[model samples]
Target: MPRPTIEDVAARAGVSRALVSLVLRGSPKVSAGRRAAVLRAAEELGYSPHLMARSLASRTSHVLGVMVSDLHNPFWAEVVDGLDAGARSAGFELVINTGGRSPARERQALTGLLSFRPAGVALLGPVLPASAFTGASAHTPVVLVSRSSRVSTVDTVNDDGRAGSAMAVDHLVSLGHREIAHIDGGNGSQSAPRRTGYVTAMRRHGLTPRVVRGEYTEAAGAAAVRALLSPAPPTAVLAANDLNAVGAISALEEAGLSVPGDVSVVGYDNTWLAALRHVSLTTIDQPRAEMGRLAAEALVHRVRGERVTPARHLLPPRLVVRATTAAPRAMSGL
Candidate 1:
C-alpha cells in the first residue's frame, strides 16, 4: 500500500501542500480554520511527517528536542516553560522527554532525541558523562543546563552551586545554627559543587560538618532523615532540593519533631512547591526559568551562526527566607 503523503492530506483538506507543510510545522502563518482542517485530514489519512526530507530541503530544522533528568521535580517544569517560550519566539518547536534521573537512561533518551535530527538539544540537569555530552554536541548544537563543561563546543547554563550552598550555610549560621547537617544531592548534576561548598562553609565557621547521602527525590530525603535519628541529630538540615526538603519534613514530623523549632530545614531550587503557603520552605532560588531561557538563547545563537565561541553562563543564586528557618532555640536569648 502506498503511504499517505503531505500532498494527500493537502488535497483532502483542500489546501496547498505548502499550507499543509506550514500546519505540520506548526507555523504561525497558518489560519486557525485551515490548520484544523489540515490536522483533521492528516489524522484521518494517518500521514506521518517527512521530517528527514523536510529537514534536508530547508537546512533549517524547526524541531528542538529537550531531555530533562527528572520530571518529578517541579523545577524542570518552570525551566521548560522558559525554553519553550524562547524556542517558539525564535521560530522553533520543542519536544521534551525525561530519563527520570538515571545516567544510562538519560543517554538513551538523548540518543533518541538526536536521532530525530533536531536543530539543537537542550539537556536540563542531565546526569550523563561529559564525554556523552561532547559526543552529542559534535552531531548537533547542545546546550546544557545545571552542568558544567570544559568543551567549548557545548554551551552551558548553571547556577553557581558552590556559592548557592555557601549562601545556605551562611543563612543557617546567621540564624545561630552551629550543628547543621547537609542532605547531599547524591550523584545529581552539580551535586559535588554543593557538597564541597557545604564543607568549606562549615570549616570557615569553625563548625563540624556532617553529610547525609540522598538522591534528588522526596523519598530519599525522607529516608536520610529517618537514618539521622541516632548519634544526636544535627539541629538543622540543608536539603538537596525542594522536593527532597518536603520529604525531610514528613520524616521529621513522623519522628515527633516540629520544624523550625526542633529542626530547621532549608531546601534548594526554590521551586513552586517550596513557595507554597503550607510548605513555605526556606530555599536557595537558582533563577531556573532564566537559566532555561538563556540556554535556549545560547543554542539559537549557534544555530544562527552568531557565536562560534561556546557561551558559558553562570548565574548567581539567592537565599529566600521563609517560615522554615528561624534562630536556633539555644540562642533565642541572644
Candidate 2:
C-alpha cells in the first residue's frame, strides 16, 4: 500500500501544503480551528513527517534523543514516560534507543543519537565512562539521568543512591537484622554509591558488612544467593534493584526458604515491579518520572541557551517498605 504523504493531508484538509507544513511543525501562526482541521486530516490520512528528512531540511530538530542503558529494566520505561510527557507538552518529540547495559553498546547508542543531529540527548543510566559522556556532549547538549559527572559540559539528574542504600540498611537493622548480605550491582551505573552506602550503614550499626558479587540480572542475583548460602547465609539480603530482589526471592524459595520469614529481601528502584501484587517488594523510590521531567527541562534550557552551566540535579531517594522485608527469622541452616 502506498503511504500517505503531506500533500495528501493538505488536499484532505482543503489547505495548502504550506499551511499543512506549518500545522505539522506546530507553528502558532495557524489558527486553532485550522490546526485542528489539519491534525484531523493528518490522522485520517495517516500522514506523518519523515523524521530524518524533516530534520535534515530544517537544520533544526524538534526531536530529543534518549538512550536507555537497559530496556529490560522497567525503571527506564517509567522515566521515559515522564520525559515524553514533559517534552510533548513543550512542543518536542522523543526518539528512544537502548544499549542493553553494555558500555560499548552505550557508546554506539550515543553515537547513533548524535547521527540524527537531535537538539539534545538524554542518556539514562548509561554504562559509558565520564569521558565518553563528555565527548558526546561536545557534539550536542546532553543531559544524563542516573549518572554523575564532574565535567561542566554534561548535565546530570540522579537520585541519591548512597542515601537510598543507607536507608535500606538502617531499616533492616531496625527490624532486627544483623547478618545482612548485599548483592552488588557490579559495573552498573551508580553501583559504587550504593555499595559504599551499604558498607557505611552496616559498619555504623556495628555489624560486619557482607558483600557478594552480583550484576543487574535475575540470573546474577540467583547465582550470588547460592554463593552466599555456602558461606553462612545472611538472614537478610539487599539486592541491587527490584528485578534483582525478585530473582533473589525466587532463588531463596527454590532453596526451600521464605521471604521475610526465613530471610528478608530489599530492592532498589521502586518501579511498578516492586508494587506488583505477587512481588510487593520493599525498595527505594527514585522519583523516576520526576527525574525524567527535570532532565527534559534541563535539556530545553541548554538547547534554548537559557543556561550555560550544567544542571546537576541530585534528588533525594526514599525508602518504600513493603511485604518482602521484615525482621529476620531465627532459622537453622539450610
Candidate 3:
C-alpha cells in the first residue's frame, strides 16, 4: 500500500491541502476545530510529515547532529543524556553517530552529519585536528564537549583536567603515598593537561613522577600495571579514567596484590562504574552531563544567531574519595 501523505489527510478531513499544511505547521490562522479534524485524520491515516523534506523546503532544520568519539565509554553516554535533554526542550531533535575514537572516522562522521544540513553540530571528545573543525565550523555552528579549541567560530565546554589531576595527586600524597605512578591517556582529548597537572603536583611535593604511556583503554591500564610490577610498582597509581583504573585494579589483584592495602588507585572521570561497591574507585569528577548541556546551549545559541562571539565554558572538577585509596601500608601501621 502507498504510504499516507498530506493529500490523503486532506481528503479524509474534507479540507484543502493548503489548510492541512497550515494546520500541520501549527499556524494560528487555522481554527481549532479544523486543526483538530486535520490532526485526527492524519493520525487515522498513520500519516506523518517528513522532517528532512520539511527542513529542506523551509530552509530551516530542527535537527541537531552529535558525533561522539567513543561509544564504548559510558562517560560519553552520560554526556549525551544532557545533550538530548537540552535539545529536546528547545524543540530540536538529535541525530547521533560515533567515530570510534579515530580521527579519520571522526572526519567521515562529521561529513555525514553535514550532509543532512542540521541546524548545528556537537562533537564529544573529538580527536579531529583544528583544521577539520575550522572547516566544519565554516558551514555549521559547532560546539565541542570535553575538548578545547581556539577557533573563533566554534564553542567549547570542558572541565579543568589539570586541576582535577592535581587534586588526585595531592590526595595520594596526603595518604603518605610518595612513590606514585600515573597511567596517562595518550592521544586522548584533555590528556596533556591531565599529565601536566600530575607532573606539576608531584614535583611540588618533592616527589619524582613516574608516568606510563597508555591509551584510554582497560587493556592499556592493565599492560601499564604489568610493566610497573617488574620494575618495582609504585605504592599508589593514578589512572587515566575509571575504566582504566578498574583494569589496573584487576591486574593488581591477579598478581596477588590487594587494593588500598598493597597499592592505592585513583582515577579520573567519576563515571557510574566508579561507584560500584566492588569497584569503589576514588576519582576526579567532571560534570559530564553539565558539559553536554552547555555544549547544546552553545550550539543552539549560535544556530539562532543569538551569539556571535565564541563561548568557552570551563567547569571546575572535584575529587571523590572512595574505598580504592588509603594510607600507604607503612604509614597505616604508624
Candidate 4:
C-alpha cells in the first residue's frame, strides 16, 4: 500500500495542503486548533515526515535545531539570545523547542528535532540520558550547554559550577557568616559539582556544611528554606541559582526576617532578573550568553566538518556583589 502523505492529512483535517505542510514543519504561524487537527489526522493515518529526502533534494540545510530544558527560567532567555545572534550571523536559522525540564520530554524533543534532519542541534541544560546524546549524534552534530556527555561525537559548554559555588561560600564566610546553609540543585545538571564545592569550602572554613534539598526552581528554594527554619536558622544561605535565591528571600521575608539583617543570601547565575534594582541579588555570574555562542560555534564547525575533536568549553564564573548580601548581625554588632 502507498504511504500516507501531507495531502492525505490535509484532506482528512479539512485544511489546505500548505497548512498541512506548515503544521508538519512545526510553524508557529499555524493556529493551535488547526495544528491539533492536522496532527490528529496525520496520527490516524500513520503519516510521517520525510525531512531527509527533502534535505537531499535541496542539497543544503540552513536550519539548526535547539532544545531548551526550561523556558520559564530567565537564564535561558539570555543564553538563547546569544545562540540566535550567532546562528543568524552564520547564515542559519534556529528552530527552538522546550523540554519543560522533563527527561522524557527532552528525549521526545530530541527525537523530533532529529526527524527534521537539520545540519546540527544544540541542547540547552537537557536532562536526557547519555544514550540519547550518542544516538542523536549518529545522525547529526550535537552540542550541549549546561550538560555533559561522554559520547565522542558530542561537544559540551558549561560554566565552572564547583568554583562558582565555592565563590559564594567564600563571600559568605568573608562576611562572618559561620552558620551558613546551601540550597543545592538536587539531581539537576552540574548539581554534584556545585554541592561538592559548597561542602569543600565549608569544611575549609571550619564550618559545618548544611545542605538542603532543592531543585532549579523558586518553589524548591522556598521549600528548602522553610525546612531550615526548624532549630536555629542559618545566618546566610547559598541558593542553587538566582531564581532560587529570590524565592529564598521571599520566604525569609514572610518569616519576619530582614534580608542581610536576619539572613544574607547568595545566588548562582547572574541572570538579568538577578540584577534588577528591586532584586539586586548577589550571585555567581556565569557567562550565559558566551556559553550559548560557543555551543553554536562548535555545532556549526562540526556541521561544516571544520573540526573533528570534541569541543569542551568550561567557562569561569565570578561573584557579583549586590544589595542582597551583608555581614551577620553578630559580626556587625547591630
Candidate 5:
C-alpha cells in the first residue's frame, strides 16, 4: 500500500492541494472550518507531513528540543504531555532526551539536541549549571521548567517551592505533630528553597528542625528513614517527592510502623502515584502540566522574536490532603 500524501488529503477533504498545504503549514489565512476539514482528512488518511523534507525545503526547522532530568519519574511524563500538546498546536514537534539526573549527562544531552539546530530548547528540571544555559542560548532560545535563571536571555517556569514546603509543614503542625523531620532533595533544582521553607516554618512554630540529607530518589528516602529511626524517629516525616514518600512508607512498614498511625508522612509533587488507592499520599501539588505549557510558550515567543528580555513564570502550589497524613497517635514516641 502506498503512503497517503497531501494530494490524498486534499481529495478526501474536497479542497485544493494548495489549501491543504496551507493548512498543514498552519497558515492563518485558512478558515477554521477548512483547517478542521484538512486536519480530519489527514488523520483519516494517516498522512503526516515529512518534517525533514519540509525543513529542508523551507530552511526553517519546526523542531523543539527537550531535555528531561529524570525519566523514571511520572511527573516528567505528565509535563511532557502538556509540552507536546502546546508544541504541536504551534506547528512544532518535540525531540526529547534524558540526562539521568546528572549534570554532566544533561550537558551532553543539551549539546546533542543543539546539534540538530532546533528552533528552541526547553530544559525540564535540568541539573546543568547556569553557564550551560548561557552557552546554549547563544545558539538557540532556551526555556527552563522547574528551574531558575538570572541570565537575561533565558526564560524560566517554576512552582513556588518555598510556599509549597511551608504549607506541608503547617498542615502537619495543625494536625498536632510537634516533632517533624524533613527528607531533603539534595542539590536538585529548587531544593534549596524547599529546605529553607521547611526550616523557616519549623522555627516559626517554635519547633526544632531536623533535616536529613537525601536526593530525589527512593533509595535516598529509604536511607534517610533508616538514619532517623536510629535517633528516634519524629512523629511526622516530610518527603522530598512522591517517590521519596513511597520509599519512606515502605521503610516504616518494614520497621513495624503504620503510615499515618505510627508516623504521619507528607510528600511533595502530587503525582499520579500519590493518588493510588494503596498509596493515597498527602502532598504538595505543583502545576506540572501548566508549567510545561508555559515553558513551551516562552520558547515559542522567543523563537518568533516576539520578546527579548525574559519570561519568569512562578506558579503557585496547592496542598492536596490524602490518607497518608493524620494526627499523631497518643503516646507516640517522638
Candidate 6:
C-alpha cells in the first residue's frame, strides 16, 4: 500500500502543505482550528511524520531513549506508561530497551540508546556504577529513576527507601513481631538504603536484626527462606520487593508453612502483582507513575535548556497493609 504523505493530509484537511508542515512542527503560529483539522486528517489518512527528516530539518530530535533495568517486572512497565504519556504530551516519543539486571548488558543498552542521539535519556533502576552514568551524561541529558546519583550532571527520581523499609519494620513490630527477618536486595539499585533503614528501625525498636543475603528476584527469595529455616526461623519477614515476597511465600508453602498464620510476610513496591487477591501482599507503595512523570519532566526540562542544576526528586513511600501480614503466631520450624 502507498504510504500517506503530508500532501495527502493537507488535501484532506483543506489546508496548504505549508500549514501541515507548521502543524507537524508544533508551531505556535498555527490556529487551533487548523491544527485540529490537520491532526484529524492525519489520523484518518494514517499519515505519520518522518522523524529522521524532521530531525535533519530542525537539527533536533523528539526522541527520548529509556533503559529499563528489568523488563520482566511489572513495576517498570507501569513506570514506562507514565513516561510515555508525559513524553508524548511534550511533543516527544520514547525508545526503550532493557538490561535484564546485568551490569554488562546495561552498559550495552545505554550505548545502544546513545547511538540514536536521542534528545535525552531516562534510566530506570539501573544497576550500572556511577561512572557509567557519568559517561552517558557527558553526551546528553540523563535522568535516573528509582536510583540516586551524586553526579551534578545527572538528575534522579527516587522513593525514600529508608523510610519505606522503616515503615515495614514498624508494621511488623506493631504486630508483636520482635524476631522479624529481612531479605535484602543484594547488589541491586537502592538496596543499601533499604537495608540501612531496616537495621536502623530494628535497633530503634530494641529488636535484634537478622538479615539474609538475597537479590531482587523470586529465586533469591525462595533460597533465602530455605537457608533461614534451619537456624532459628523468624516469625515475620520483610522481603526486598513484591516479586521477592511472592517467591518467599511459595517456598514457605512448599515447606508446609502457612502465610501470616505461620510466618507473616511484608513486601515493598505496591505493584499490581502485590495487589492481586491471591497475593494480597502487604507492601510499601512507591508511586511508580508519579515517579516516572517526574523523571520525564526533568529530562524534558534539560532537553529544552530550561534547567541548569540537576533535579533531585525524593518522593515519600507509604505502607499498604494487606492479608499477607498479621500478628505473629507461635514460632516453629516447617
As for model 6, its CA RMSD to the true structure in angstroms is 3.2
Give the per-residue lDDT digits (tens) of candidate 6, residues 221-262. Answer: 999999889866788999999889999999999989899898
- Clash total of candidate 5: 0
In angstroms, give how far residue 241 of model 2 lies from its true place.
0.5
Worst 10 residues of 6 by lDDT: 325-334
lDDT on C-alpha atoms for all candidate structures: 0.91, 0.90, 0.92, 0.90, 0.92, 0.92
lDDT of 5 by residue, 1-334 (tens): 8999888999999999999988988899999999999999999999999876677666788999999999988889989988998998897999999999999999999999988888999999898888998999998999999899999999999989999999999999999999999999998888889999999999999999999989888888899999999868898999999888989999999999989998999999899999999999999999888888888899899999999989999999999999998888874444
Error of 4 at 33 (Å): 44
- In model 1, residue pairs whose N, Cα or C atoms come closer than 3 Å (at least 3 residues apart or on different chains), thus clashing, are none
Better of 4 and 5 by TM-score: 5
lDDT of 2: 0.90
How well does model 1 score by local distance difference test?
0.91
For residues 1-334, could you state the per-residue lDDT of candidate 1 as single tens digits? 7999989999999999989988877799988999999999999999988766788767778788899999989999999999988998998889789988998999999999998889999999999888998999898899999998989899999999999999999999998899999999999998999999999999999999999999899999999998887877788999999999999999999998889888899999999999999999999998977988998898899888899898999999999999998888778753
Better of 2 and 3 by lDDT: 3
Candidate 1: C-alpha RMSD after superposition: 4.0
By TM-score, the better pick of 3 and 6 is 3
TM-score of 5: 0.86
Q: If ranked by TM-score, best first, what sequence of candidates would result?
A: 3, 2, 6, 1, 5, 4
Which has the higher TM-score value, candidate number 3 or candidate number 5? 3
> How many residue pairs clash (N, CA or C atoms closer than 3 angstroms) in each of the candidate models, in the order given?
0, 0, 0, 0, 0, 0
Q: Candidate 6 lDDT (Cα, whole model)?
A: 0.92
Stretches > 4 Å off in candidate 3: none
Candidate 5 lDDT (Cα, whole model)? 0.92
Off by over 4 Å in 1: 1-5, 9-53
Model 4: per-residue lDDT, tens digit, 40-59? Answer: 99999999866565466556
Indicate the TM-score of model 4: 0.84
Itemize residue pairs with steric clashes in candidate 4.
Answer: none
